[model samples]
Target chain A: MKIFQQSSEFDYSWEEVSTSNWRKYGPWNEKTPHVIAVDTISRTIDPHTGILRTERLITCKQSAPKWVLSILGGQDTSLVYETSYVDPAHKKVTMCAMNITWSDVLSVRETCVYQPSSSAPDAKTNFVQRAEITALCGGWQKIKNSIEQFTVERFQQNAAKGKEGFEMVLEMSRKVFAEQREMLRLQQESKILQEARI
Target chain B: MSASLAPECNQVKEQYDNCFLKWYSEKFLRGTATSDECESLFKQYEQCLSKALKARGIDSMLREAREDNRENDAEHMRPKP
Candidate 1:
């Protein structure tokens, strides 16, 4: 088994960061352009705590080496199942994801957490991500080692691109949010002016 | 907005996503949401998506994954800092 971990900070509030997560995989992200679709499978809110839970499936185009592709029957796409929990009261978001395609040969499980920075709770968000990759190929220790090494290298590269893409999406979400707020302010001002004339 | 995995479900999925986004930012995050407002749209999208999942033989795998991960589910509503 191979493990990978990453920690970083987003220069935005936790609310902003979490909200942007929903829009992270669109065309705005050129760095991680392999994402093709994201489908919400289920969603529910805990009535008592107001915490929201969502299940989603993400489809992405795979780019494995020719040999690996051949081993997997030349499949070109992979599916990932992800589950997320948003605790508004605690101001934290946690997501867990696992690959569904080719699970018999390789297993990749990942977890991510987003919370307010401990030092600057109001202004910054802390992001932590971890992944565990295991080669399920039995009786072929050499093949397993090679597959693990290759996957780790690819995982590292993808992680970097994923962070870059997420930042772009965050910026886009912030702009849209700001525009909506501005529009609401203008409508309120117009309403006040009309009331004054009456 | 992200597209649904199945092309046939895209329209209904979009409707549900828009509704959920509004509720998430304006109500759910703000502690003002009283009830879910997108359930019907979600059901509509689910119908289409389930067919796609079944066709691709992913539905059973999804069910198994969910069960395996149940024990590792995130702890909810931790004390605020």
Candidate 2:
């Protein structure tokens, strides 16, 4: 089993960051072209905590290494099942994802937590992500090691791209939200002026 | 917006997503949401998606995955406050 962990901060409030997370794979993000489809399978709100829980399936298409593909019969598309909890009262979001495809041979499970940064609680959000990778090759110890190494490298590269893509989405949505707010303000002003004339 | 796994479910999925987002930002986050506003739309979209998943034989895989992780469910997975 191989473990990977990373921590980062986004210069945005918790609300803004969490909102942008839903739009991470919007059309504007060029970095995540491999993601083909995303489906929300189930969603429910806890009556007690008012926390929202969501289950989603994300399908991604990526070409594996030639050797790995040869060993595993040429499957290029992968499916990931992800569950997330949004605790509005506590201002935190936790997401857990695991690969549903090829789990018998190689399994990757990831968890992410998003919360307010202690240093700049109102202005910045902190993100912590951890992934566990396990490869079972049925007595092929050498093959298992190779697979783990390769997957770790690939995961690292993808994580970097994912962060970059999310930042772009965040910036784009911020501008759109600002514009909408301004439009609403103008509409209210016009309504007031019309009322005065009447 | 992201596309649904099934092309036929895309339209309904988009509608549901829009409703959910509005409720999430305006009501849920504010602790004022009385009920889920997108439940019906989600059901419609899920029906369409279920057909696709079954057709692709992915439903079983999803079920197994969810079951295997039942012990480590999201409620117990949150980080310490």
When just chain B is superposed on the true chain B, each candidate scores a TM-score of 0.87, 0.87
lDDT of 1 by residue, A1-198 (tens): 999999999999998888888878877777887888999988988766667888899998999899777655577889898989899988889898998888888889999999999989999999999999998977688888888888888989999999999999888888988897787777677977456653
Compute each candidate's TM-score over C-alphas.
0.92, 0.94
Worst 10 residues of 1 chain B by lDDT: B72-81
Q: What is the interface RMSD of each candidate, in Å?
A: 2.2, 2.5
DockQ of 2: 0.59
Native contacts retained per candidate? Answer: 0.60, 0.60
- Candidate 2, residue A85: the lDDT equals 88
Model 1 score (lDDT): 0.86
CAPRI verdict (incorrect, acceptable, medium, high) for model 2? medium
TM-score of 2: 0.94
**Model 1, C-alpha of A196: deviation from truth (Å):** 20
Q: Please give the distance, in angstroms, between residue B64's alpha carbon in candidate 2 and its true position after superposition.
A: 0.6
Which portions of model 1 miss their true places by more than 4 Å?
A190-198, B74-81
Candidate 2 off by > 4 Å: A191-198, B74-81
